[model samples]
Target: MIRNLLVAALLAGSATVADAAQWNFSYVASVGTISGQIDGTLQGDANTIFVSSLSGLQFNGTPGPALPFLASASSVVGGIPGPPALSLDGSANNILACSTDTVSSGCTSDGFAFVPAGFFAPPPVFFSGPAYGGAFFESYNAANWSITPAAIPEPSSWTMLIAGFGLVGAVVRRRQVVTRAA
Candidate 1:
């Protein structure tokens, strides 16, 4: 019984680790700074993850328009529309872009891109523009990108773990009492 409880607890704990992960990203852009959280499952390549959704996405320390759900990674090239190149690479070695409008409509409406070294041009590369074509587009110098994973276990997880340990202790204590009586 104690062994079964131990195995059950171990399996339950691993389940939470396998679920979706939360990645925090932040970068300074020409127009302003952008920061947000990406939630999704990591792909085979640890550096990339298929984006499921975004939260806390802000521009210049203020919230911006809602971004269209992206199917995959892409690029933000001078406010020009293009495919999702290496946008989702968390390593920051590739271009990372986000679109406010539907991806099908193009990134022209409103979007931001973070370009690391070895991009189309040299260093100091970033593309940003206003929403709904407000006529505010600029490529500024010096952009930084940081993406890291953050995880917090749920309260239920702790409760289950503690209960499992308690059960194991009770079984061991009962066995000791029986041995002494015999």
Candidate 2:
């Protein structure tokens, strides 16, 4: 009986390790509405793993280009203290390229960044201009930055849970069989 309990406990614990989450983020910016899904493990203080890897990214209504490796330090997820929100930094250290057109493969001429208050240089936030001859730069504040938790148990987690239940069921069945024979 103790062995079965121990096995169940270990399986339950292992499921926690394989837990994962997906956060859908959206907010208005000077350029347009920025939105995407961030996929990563929701384990506390380790949420930076989802910073650079953004999916379903869109600007206004157009799809954004594939992003390069962004700095994890410039972003924050549910793994830290504060409101359940996602904060992205596009400071000089983390220059995030703003995709303006669907044809460009990279951020050759345009870029934007979110400089957290009191973190980098002054003026808080700003958006840069496009590379197609017309140059423009403007400063704006980013508000309503929403980051919500959408969790899904990993496959290994489900497997471990099912196996644990099966093991416990077997143990109970064996006990019943022994009692009936006696």
Candidate 3:
């Protein structure tokens, strides 16, 4: 009975630790709406979230860029405008480019280009409703965004969790046998 309880407890703890974080995002523009999934990671000791990788990106029913896009949000301070900022390369034509700015034009980069405070209201909030903005090349007038966390466990994490559970079970069982004999 004790062994079962111990194993269960250990397993539960491991499960929690094995969870990985993910980000789900979507945006709407006049040209069309784009939605996709991004692998997310927490920035160091801050209330900021970063998108490390992107996958399953679809823009207006077409496959989107696979480049890495970085996003971050700042809190409103002293009545100053705090908005979520996204960084990506832009082509010479001011079109959204790939991850790197130095990349050649028409390299199929992923990015956004807009004049600050030109279209959307001031102070864009993270994970909030649509943010209206003017996007060059495309008629992207409004952008709706959302962020979601995903849980993914690394292989090493699984291995360590299993090993920990085994160790804990062994210790608990040894204690139980000693108590019985005593």
Using TM-score as the measure, the top candidate is: 1
Off by over 4 Å in 2: 1-21, 39-50, 72-111, 117-121, 128-137, 140-142, 160-182
Lowest lDDT 10-residue stretch of candidate 2 = 76-85
Candidate 3, pairs of clashing residues: 20-152, 22-150, 97-109, 97-110, 98-109, 98-110
What would the per-residue lDDT of candidate 1 be over residues 1-182, giving only the tens digit for each residue?
Answer: 66765675574454243243777777655445677777766666666665566677787677866555453223433454433322344343333334545544435446554444444545434555564223233343433556777675666766776766776667678778978999
Best by lDDT: 1
RMSD of each: 6.5, 8.9, 9.6
Candidate 2 lDDT, tens digit per residue, 27-61? 56545666677655443544332343556766666
What lDDT is reached at residue 81 by model 2?
26
What TM-score would you give candidate 2 relative to the actual structure?
Answer: 0.47
Off by over 4 Å in 1: 1-20, 71-101, 114-125, 131-143, 154-182
Order candidates by TM-score, high to low.
1, 2, 3
Q: For candidate 3, what is the total of clashing residue pairs?
A: 6
Runs in model 3 lying further than 4 Å from the true structure: 5-9, 17-21, 39-41, 44-47, 50-52, 68-143, 154-157, 160-182
- Cα-lDDT of candidate 2: 0.49
lDDT of 1: 0.54
Quote each prediction's TM-score.
0.53, 0.47, 0.46
Q: What is the C-alpha lDDT profile of model 3 across 75-180, one tens digit per residue?
A: 2112223323332211000122234443233223445432233233453221211121223344323324444555677777677678777777777887789899
